[model samples]
Target: MIEVENLTKKYGDARGINDVTFTVEKGEVLGFLGPNGAGKTTTMRILTCFMPATSGKAKIAGFDVFEDSLEVRKRIGYLPESVPLYTDMQVPVYLEFVAGLKGVDRRDVKRRVSHVMDDCALNAVSKKYIGELSKGYRQRVGLAQALINDPEVLILDEPTIGLDPRQIIEIRSLIKSLGGRRTVILSTHILPEVSMICQRVVIINEGRLVAVDTPQNLTAQLQRSQQILIRVGGPEKEVLSEVGKINGVSRVSVKENGADNINAYLIELKKDMVDAGKDIPPVIVRKNWSLHEMRPVGMSLEDIFIKLVTEEKIN
Candidate 1:
């Protein structure tokens, strides 16, 4: 539902985003990830029509973000990082006002406001002034306004900022539930949140598109070997020596020494090696050692993000 090609933005000499190209499929929830000053918010603003890119093109729901901004805005809801809210207005009143601004039918404004309030769990604070609400509640109010129009696309920038743990989970669940119904571009520094809620991720760094793929796929692409963590009740040195000799085991190191002679070892196998979990157990048993746990460990999303962002510096 959204397409951006070679989009570039600049504030004079400082480039916001350069040659950043990606597409968000209809009904897809895409995570936009980057470190601070990585142009994530800049890209979102261009896509949401909050700002124009200096060059290149962005289209939302088939309408050009620059040429048909009004039509594009009509089909998308945006919750910026710093929500622009009327502190003087009551929760429901503020939402109702936004609903009207989004061109919701007057007859359905009340119903839309009520529905979004419930969806955002803001019904209890419906009568409370936004200025009086807590930070978390105000963030919810921002989200409520975004959904008031039931737009086909939602561009949420740090939608969970300032939310408590419970509120974070509630908001995550709400965003996840919207996956197949609305095209969402979620920008946040929280890596795990993206892993849980986003179908795919677009990672940018230093104003350039670094990588874009499913988390699982990215892990596979970046992983050069299989890492297995195993806990065994045996002499650490002997177990390490024996495991190191096992076929397909390229390297082994003691991760931790536990009480009662139990130890955790991290084993690294060659990329083409046989399954370490299956091969290492029988060896441990024959050696009269207790096999407590064996599991393959893959690179996490955070690891992938770090690698993608730092690979250039390292190289």
Candidate 2:
């Protein structure tokens, strides 16, 4: 479990982060999202005890990050954006070195190194020097080092950055598998990463927390009007006219025309209108039009992220 309250970090005249606060429940995977220069890394650094905040409080597994840095570090595994690695060391050797640094017992060091290497899919390159490995493998090595200690919390900063599509998927899957067993804080600007891997999102902009919620809840909160997409088999003008007359219908426009006289219409309902699902189908039946399909349109995480960030900037 983690808790942060009014965390602020300043760099002279500029603020790294100001009054940012959120929490990650035990075994919860939280996404730390923000655009470039939005203090995402700054926040992570403070939480990891890599740097100190200008003001406020942060705790990891009940230990204050500032006052109990060592205890906090003991319970956390961190993979920073730029992983610090010994390029000349072999993969297994590198991890073994990290295990010692994390204070793993001498007798357990070998086992821990082997276990993490296997977990990270680095056994094939166990003997290969880190510098000789590809970027993807190098990242795996970084992750292995982070896990060598088997910390209760995992703090990952841009874990998938600069990887090819295939590598990214591989890394994403690995991270996803770690959820529910370890409380994870995944920091990245990638929308798909959050949507696919994180259970909740904390959006930061210009060093301030803008939104914190599950993606579905955030989408619902941001939607002012409801949108419904309906496919009707009938004359376009007649179907549109009939649907537009519904009580809450505000606007209707053709979305697509199918081959057999079926057309898809996008209907926008008035704000706070919650009865489109109940109201639309009966209206279509009354008009004698075949209602092929009807579904509510939900905003994508990208849309929500952009909207939240834009609104934060405007305010």
Q: Find the candidate with the highest TM-score and give its number.
A: 2
Model 1 per-residue lDDT tens digits across residues 108-143: 999998898889889888779999989888888888
Over the stretch 66-159, how does candidate 2's per-residue lDDT look in tens digits? Answer: 9999999988999989887888888888787789889999999999988988888998997788889888888888888888898899999999
| TM-score computed on alpha carbons, candidate 1 | 0.93
Q: In angstroms, how far off is 269's CA in candidate 1?
A: 0.8
Report the Cα lDDT for residue 257, model 2.
92
- List the pairs of residues colliding in candidate 1: none
CA RMSD per model (angstroms):
1.9, 1.8
Error of 2 at 213 (Å): 0.9
Off by over 4 Å in 1: 235-238, 259-261, 274-276
The model with the greatest lDDT is 1
For each candidate in the order shown, give its overall lDDT on alpha carbons. Answer: 0.91, 0.90
